[model samples]
Target: MNCDQRAIRFNCLGSSMIGIIDLPERPLPRGVLVVAGQPDSRLGAQRQFAMLARALARRGFAVMRFDRRGVGDSEGCDYNDSDVRAAVQEFCQQVPGVREVVLLAPGSGSAIATASACARIDPRVRALLLLDPRRRANAARTAHMLAPPVPAPAPIGAALFWRRSQPPRRGPSSGARLAGLAEQLCAFPGQVLVVAATSAWAGPTPAQAEVRQLRALVERAGTSNRVQIIDDAAPAPADRAAGGRLDGDALRAATCASWMVSW
Candidate 1:
């Protein structure tokens, strides 16, 4: 499979945001949206996002990555739902071959991805691939980074695609945000694949503690989902390090490919 890339721009709030898309000669209707956490550009740690996008594209998915508001080429003061929603919209609009989408959120960004998909912010979003899902270690930092979405809308069923973007409130405590995410996730209708990164070599546990929580919540959602635990050759790094310099990139890639085919 061969892949190519292009630049794309969209509007979030009053600001203009930019992203990159990896295109395959022939693409599946389901695309991928790679959400980079706030203060991090789409380039991801050491440009690993760039590498991942191309890899997914080669696997026959239309893949995309972009800057958060106020980061990279995007223009905005901070992160918000509108940023993720806008990116979702752009992904669907730009990739004519893509109908539904899957989100791949590496770390804290998993919080954002869960909010968007589980909350039903966009109808096109169908599944999630979360890598080492974990919350921020610092509560105050989490407050500074995340903004809570508006009260969720009633389930619209067939009306989902025509729904409008929900409003948002900025700077909530991590505890508050986590509680909200828990509630929404239990209602999410899509399948979730959580990649729990840990191992004896990884020096903690082969299964992450957060992975257990995530699985429990997802199972309660009443949807069929899967959890795949792969051993890390070394202790897992923070989101930044994991994204950029992990020696287990090939393993992650293989896992993604396998799950996607099974999906």
Candidate 2:
């Protein structure tokens, strides 16, 4: 099926922002705004964003992928949540009869989306699909990693243990940042889908605290159903048959779209 893709230029704070809208021949009531992380264009690495837009359009949705100010063809010197809001508004205008809008952000874009959602900048944004939201270990967590594991009990005699001599160069503390991000995301009055790459999933790592906090906050807010997690580990054969491509990302995007379609 052929979808109409149009290159659009819109004004934002006296600067021009460029975006592409994929309009399905037979539109649905939903629209999706695909936000790129810092330093990534709308096309995304390996054209994952483009592929995602096409996939969503094939499923009868209005999808928009755009470059933030100062990136790609957009004219500006900075990028921020305001720029994302501008893009979302532009996307909504291009897709007629869209009753709901979903914000899909991969990587660091998750932070931006979370900020926007917490602020409730746009009421039309009904959900968030965060594919690999940025997560990193904090200084304390790093120290813990460098610390030696506790000795096993006498009954468990085969446990191996090792310790590093010294802690390496310390990175900035990320606990506060990650905690704030999670809080903001949970504050959103809509659904949130967090899709993490197994390679980076925090569930069983030093960064698990932040992920756990997010889940706890969501549950406390009484919107546990509003948050979902997808651990994308081994890529499906179909996704990998494309050769050296970022098939995992494409698969994640497709799965997200399908989930939204059923919503």
For model 2, residues 105-191, the per-residue Cα lDDT tens digits are 764534544536533767788887776554322324466678898986553333322223345676545566656656666666777
- Candidate 2 vs. true structure, TM-score: 0.72
Candidate 2 — which residues are off by over 4 angstroms?
Answer: 109-119, 134-178, 199-221, 238-246
| Cα lDDT, model 1, residue 75 | 85
- In terms of TM-score, the best-performing candidate is 2
Query: Candidate 2, which ten residues in sequence have the lowest lDDT sum?
Result: 156-165
Clash count per candidate: 0, 0
Which whole-number lDDT from 0 to 100 does residue 235 have in model 1?
Answer: 30
* lDDT for residue 42 in candidate 2, whole number 0-100: 93
Name the lDDT value of residue 119 in candidate 1.
37
Clashing pairs in 1: none
